[model samples]
Target: MSAGEFYYDQKVLENHLISLVPFNQDLHVSKLIHEVNTHDLLKYIPFPPFESEEEFIKNFWEPVLNAPGECLYAIIDKATAKESGESNAFAGTMALTSTSKENAVTEIGILIFPAFQRTHVATNAAGLLLQYTLDPPSAGGLGLRRVEWKCHSENAASRRAALRMGFEFEGIARWHRICPVGVSVEALEKRNGTKGEQRGRHTAIFSITWDEWDEKRPKIVALMERKY
Candidate 1:
């Protein structure tokens, strides 16, 4: 199989709690811009907080849109409805990138808004993504052999979430990449005469192989399917 074969006709994955659908720029971009501007949710992420809608598009959405072999999905809370007086149902975004068809591997990256954190939203969204990635093609899965979860080592919350979702801690990459200073941190430091510091961010890598998923799938399914 080729990369295109795996990504072709990317499907919508959903459960009782959340829905993972292919991100639509027109519909999602504005919502994302509002969320980013209103909250400091993107602080731990590599990119700086988006100051405007265009910056959000050029810096975040456009890259994912143009990246070949990458599938990005908007995380929607199934419980929320526009008629309920909300501007949008979107909660965050998750992605599968660095996919290798011959090797049957891909990496999962996620960003959940502050409003949705600590709920079952992240776990169920992850479970749905995992289900779609590991299940066989005939059964509507990506048929992947390995799925990776990598995060900044300093991100303890992310590490905990990965372990809870059944991804095993593999190892850490030191000085993995350069990341911008978060808005809050930068602001506090600027008040003390320091600013514009980009630092090396260490990354912790975790993974769930096909066999591991086979063992863990039932438990995850039960967890996601249970009343929330």
Candidate 2:
């Protein structure tokens, strides 16, 4: 199948804890701005900090929205009640990027806000994405053979989460890319006792192949179902 044929019919996904929908700029920009300001969600990645909503749109959102074979979704908390009586409040963003129809593979990138981290929010959101991506085309799924999760080697939390969710460690790509430390220079100095730029990092790669998914899916489902 072609890229367009495989990705054209994007769908909304949900479970008891969270809802995943096609990202809408108008609906998500405000919440995203707040998340970015309060949380260092994009620090490990190469993306620069967002200085304004306009820059966020131009540099971040638009690129993802327009990218071929990418499906970006806004994560919403279903249990959070809003003044508008809507239980689904924007929590963060996640994406299935670098999708290849010919290879039947994709990478999952997630950015869960601070309020929702260490909770079932990330687990459920990931579970929903995995289920959608690994399900066979005949079953209304991506029919993918592999799904990758990559993060900064120094990001212990991300690496832990990847393993906890059944992604196996592949290896590290040394000096994979230059990534910002995700903090102001002062803050970085205070925390690490050195200038942020002086510290270099590597990329840790992980993956859950289709065969592994068969074994890991149930564990993930059970984890998501547990009370946290």
Candidate 3:
């Protein structure tokens, strides 16, 4: 299924450096596989490292993209596209998940391909989505009241990234989830108290609410507009 009502019908978002397109399996799957052919790059996230497209489709594609109030977008880099001869640069993927139309809320998840991790792709792409999801509908945006960023509490880099994008730290949820062993790479509990196949994940939640958007938006814009 496509995205639920919480997300507007719009399909594409772009800026000078990056473009966010709803992921299409037929068009994007192969490219995604090519970019992240190895499983090591995905060890930090949940699920096993898939070696084949079938595994990826079964473990990732269906579980994520087919869920209610969730939609995935491919982050395309124009600079890479120009260098490679491909139509667009396939940098990584991000998603709008846990959406609620009634509450006007959504959560974002992002995964940057290994090659594109330390550069401008992540910031610029994140800025574009934040802009689209929080801006008023009259401004051709979603008018969402809240945009959340949730990640493993042990993943300090993730928390920092969210803060960099204007998401304020809300606090941690202890034993927030039961993750399969090896899946919770950032789980400090793995080496501490947790045992057996199931490990507990401490989740860190962050958010940018509508009330704070006016003040935060400009700061994010300035970060995005800076020359790399």
Candidate 4:
């Protein structure tokens, strides 16, 4: 893909706590790499830490940006402007990935830097993306029918967060993916894959369909708006 090419039409999404903007590698890679490296944020995603910035760009940024339906979003916190000497800090990333127009489906992936993890950033970011991804045309959203959230079955926190964000659990897929042996993944009886010289994990699947959006969206909005 060329430097300026971007696929997703909707570029900026905002709420009370965050602004989710299309991620620009040139502008965001530096701060993002530093935070990911220092905080080791990808442990749950199970991707090993990048060896270098070039490696991060090539391995992480390139593939996601080049994919037709995928887009990375930088989660910018609306608070603490002067402390960071900016309007908003690069709090983390939220991505809409594995999109399918035919199926009208997409998945949301989140990584909240340690500094912003336990606060309202993750909730607000996920809430905004949900509203944008599933709302109908009359509501000025993508009008997609389904949005998914999947995580390693052993990652209890992730599954809880998914449920909290209004994604309904759809059962576990045993040995759903092959991952490295020691990337913070806990072993389970169903995950015994070693053929590829890597371990596997059961995947916990969750989704919210358009039919359920009217009911779910308000709950998520309330969570996002609730003051800490």
Candidate 5:
């Protein structure tokens, strides 16, 4: 169930499932564009034989930062790590796919940096994302109605994360598509590149509706407060 490993022959579509995110970097609702981009963390997520950090950042970084339907964010430790002045860093990026021009339903996506994986950080970030996305914009939120967490069937870690954050499991889309595994040069493209005969695996979908989110907020907020 570890996100770090998978058992499928075709690379799970998780590779394509990057975390798109949003956050209140500043107090103003109009300042949402200021949210951080953590795509640089993807370099560390993949296995080694990894190229220099700079190269990895250059190639794979911007797609997450500048993605058409996604937003990204970084979680810094406030205090720097001992080895360098670099802030103790983790990724807490989420993607919100708008259901309409007014953006009523926003499907979410997320990923955590390897160093910060398997901890409260992931859950906290998810809670924040949910809170910001589903709350009314009048309350400085997005007023969204639905949020989704879709993962490759083989990415048990991601599935677990969604469940832990209280998202409801929907169904799966078999043969979703293919992408690279970790940083491997090998790509798992679909058979004939058609929806037909595609060799990809299922995308496990999890979702939370606005009402359930509203009902759950008091408990989630209390849990998050305890973690801080």
Candidate 6:
């Protein structure tokens, strides 16, 4: 994706809005950062938030709001056709980090509202995120060479979703993560340069290359049609 264009601009975020049934203001493109800082919706994921929404906005989201290599989006539920509900902040976000020599690798993770979990919302939203990451810039995409899906080794739902979406099995990273812990509390007692000591439980990595994606696209599309 070009620096100014969001997520390769291969597909306009606006276009996705058209597919959102009944239209929810929470999913509006303008409220992206606000949506992300809404901790109420993000409790599903392991990431810890700052003390308040304002704190999160100032300390985190705002800093990276214009940064390259990361793109986050709100998920819309077209199937439910419900116009009124909790605002759909970031059901999930994707990271497309720069890798070797002009190649960028993408990683995706999602957190669906409890009501929307296991429904078509996750599948459809993830599908779009994948396609957006892998599509060529000329076609309005990030043109990534590889896309990854990693999760805590024991997170079965995440693993299942990775396989379902076509990420191939890759080895695990032992003790790579731990369950959520309070960063602020730990920082107070710890000396400088020990920040890295904070850890999470084990994590498993899974990946799919563009070549693999091309091969699996037709099948995945078919499966999605049947399941969704």
Tell me each candidate's TM-score: 0.84, 0.84, 0.86, 0.88, 0.61, 0.68
1-228: candidate 2 lDDT, tens digit per residue: 111222546788988778888777767777777777767677776664576878877776666556677877888888773433443467788888888878988999998889778888899998899888887777777778999999888788999999998999999987666655452122346666665454345789999988777778899999989998
Give model 3's clash tally: 0
Error of 6 at 9 (Å): 2.6
Can you write out model 4's per-residue Cα lDDT over 1-228, one digit (the tens) per residue?
A: 222343457568996567898887766777877887777666557454575778876776676557777788888887854366443488888888888877889988998888888899999999999988899978878899999998888788899999999899999988777664335344554366434345566789999999999988888989999887
Off by over 4 Å in 2: 1-8, 82-84, 180-200
lDDT of 3 by residue, 48-130 (tens): 44556787788777776666688888898888987884445788888888788889999888888887887999999899999
Question: Model-by-model lDDT, in order?
Answer: 0.76, 0.77, 0.78, 0.79, 0.50, 0.55
- Which number leads on TM-score? 4
Poorest 10 consecutive residues of model 5 by lDDT? 1-10
lDDT of 5 by residue, 41-153 (tens): 33213211224434333444333333444444444332223344332332344444433435466666665555556655666666766777777868656677788877777
Worst 10 residues of 6 by lDDT: 16-25
List, residue by residue over 1-228, the lDDT tens digit for candidate 1: 112223446678887677888777667777777777678666656665577768866676566545666777889887774345334668898888877777889988898888788777888999988998898888888788999998878788999999988899999987666666452222334556556545557788999998877789998887776654
Candidate 5 clash pair list: 20-94, 20-95, 21-71, 21-94
TM-score for predicted model 1 compared with the true structure: 0.84
**Which residue ranges in model 3 land beyond 4 Å of their true spot?**
1-7, 34-39, 47-49, 181-196
The predicted structure with the larger lDDT, 3 or 5, is: 3
| Candidate of highest lDDT | 4
